[model samples]
Target: MEVVQTIAELRARIKTYRRNNDQTVGFVPTMGFLHDGHASLLQKARSQSGLVVLSIFVNPLQFGPGEDFERYPRNEEQDLAVAEAAGVDIVFMPSVDEMYPTPTRTTVSVSEVTTRLCGASRPGHFDGVATVVSKLFHMVQPDQAFFGLKDAQQVAVIEQMVQDLNLPVEIVPCPTLREKDGLAMSSRNVYLSVEERQQALVLSQSLQQAKTFIDNNVSGSFTSEELQRLVSKHIQTAPLAVIDYVEVLSYPTLEPFEHSHSITTLIVALAVKFGKTRLIDNLILQVRK
Candidate 1:
């Protein structure tokens, strides 16, 4: 339950904790506006490490010029309560001024994998994500870090970044937490109007439909283009669900499948606009006999 604002203070606190040989640190880096999905990450981090550190900073670098950077949710007091309840040992809630004292000229960018799905639409979004995540990894210096699979591509990107940079921390991926209706839990869920929210169920429902297709052997012969059309058709049926991208690709590599390979796992990932709020969800299927 200690809140450390500056990096120097955080380093000192971590130094004190490291002096004890038995302690292992776990870090969860997030933008504020806490939700159960974020809580799941914190709980996982708490369970795995001797001390859990949660950092809440809505990084401005990650947002494109027209994105919701200015309007992104923030409830510091509530976030602190949620983190404390989830057994976070240290809450590193740094201000933008503290994180970027001057303008940042250097940026961390990942290639190939950054050009698809959410990346294709948002433009420079993953670069911002990669840069900030690298900064957090440096700032926290934890043995293990937790991330939710809700952003599956993000998890893949961070894994690649860690491998490329040889960062000492392990990137732990947690499953996406969903609502009773199957919509993935996100802070942006608040932006959905009641009507838009209801229509949003199509995102997950279509994934379920795709899963059913796979489960029943109907998807075995479905080409990637056909699969994308199938999911897109279902999503568009709901007037409120505007398709951003519906793609089927190799699981972790995220390369599009030229043909449905028997040995490769398929990722059915999609992003849809429910009114103005963009929601994303995916289904991972192993092609097996």
Candidate 2:
């Protein structure tokens, strides 16, 4: 894969791709520590577009105070190998200096969609996410951009941003890839201890339980409050896992869940911290009347 660090070089290459090559370009932006979830996104992009561009930049803008910014994790060699193996035509790896030589004055923020769940737990988190993703969208200028649904809220925020700003790129969200044991694949999973890793399954388990509750409650007997408590209680069963936030929001808009009295789609999500590692997992379910 062709790797470029500077924005100018990357833009020049993209220009060449657009002018000379008639192939459609797909972009997958990610942090350095890639896993199966990321690979799934790359594979989706590769299948849909003729040329796939993968970006590996750990944006400091998105990380908050006491968050894992410095010790997030990085193995450039391994990431490159994985990207190439996944059929990435170009890999953009820019340093902090290259991405932000001067302090960034402009920042993108999506309201309501980012106001709850992980957004409330980590203030300015979505701002950083939106800013960097907006920058990447502008930089790559791909026909389509791919993201995993594991970050359902992030997907909502980005989609809103794209629509509000009228960006031409199509935002394609791929399904979340899970571990054989049920844990959602994450870059931070490496931070977990053997015991903590097992404890992390509660996130996914709670999601499944939420689905079961929806399946059983045909009359819409359970409220969002009950679902939140159910998930929080489930996570608490694992002492190592501390609940950050447990919420069931209306899908897409992410409005606070009020009633399940009828057929509706709800996004059941949770953010839990096992020691210093904060992990997020979610499930989307349809309720029938």
Candidate 3:
């Protein structure tokens, strides 16, 4: 796989690909420190697009004041190997300076969807996400951009942005990959101590319990409040797990639903901090009326 650092070089290479064979491109934007979760995205892109482009830049814009921006794990050597093995054609590893150039004058933000979940606690986080993603989308201009659905809220926000702005590329949402123990895979998982890692399983376990709760209540009598409490209580069982948010909202819209019978799709999402590392996991369920 070819790695290019500058937008000029990256665009020039993509231009060559377009001119030579008109190969449709698939883009996967990531913050590096790749794992099977990232590899799953790359594989998805490779299976669909003629050329796969993966960009690894830990976006500082998305990090909050106390968040792990500087300490975020990064291993470019391993990331490149993972990308190549997954059939990535181009890897864009731009410096933050190259991406920002000057202090950014503009940013992208989607409202309502950004008002809850991770967005609520990590203020301005989604704005940073939308801003950087918009920049990458314009730079790559791929036929499709692939993203993992581990951050389903992020996916919803981006999809809303693309629809409202009429961006040309398709946004493909892939499933969240998980470890055998059921913890959702994350780059931050590196920060978990052995005990904390064991505790982190509660995030996914709570999600599973939420799913079962909904399944057993096919009568559709439960409210979002009840579901939230169900998940929150389960996570609390892990003493090390600190609840960030437990929400049961309408699927892509992310609006709260009063009764299970009202919505066709429900998303049960969680963000819990285990010691210093915060982890998120979610399940999307199709409610039967």
Model 1: per-residue lDDT, tens digit, 214-255?
Answer: 778754666777678778889988987888899999889988
Model 2 regions more than 4 Å off: none
Residue 256 of model 1 has an lDDT of 82
Evaluated against the true structure, the overall lDDT of model 3 is 0.92
In terms of lDDT, model 1 sits at: 0.89
lDDT of 3 by residue, 1-289 (tens): 8999999999999998988876689999999999999999999999999989999999999999999999999998999899989999999999999999899989898999988899999999999999999999999999999999998999999999999999999999999999999989999999999999998888888889888887787586788999899889888999898888888999988998899878899999888998888898999988877
Find the number of clashing residue pairs for candidate 2: 0
For candidate 2, give the lDDT: 0.90
Question: Pairs clashing in candidate 1?
Answer: none
Candidate maximizing lDDT: 3
Q: Candidate 2 on 158-266: residue-level lDDT in tens?
A: 9999999999899999999999999999998999999999888889998888888878876766788999988888889998988888888888789885678742788
Q: Write down the worst ten-residue block by lDDT for model 3.
A: 213-222
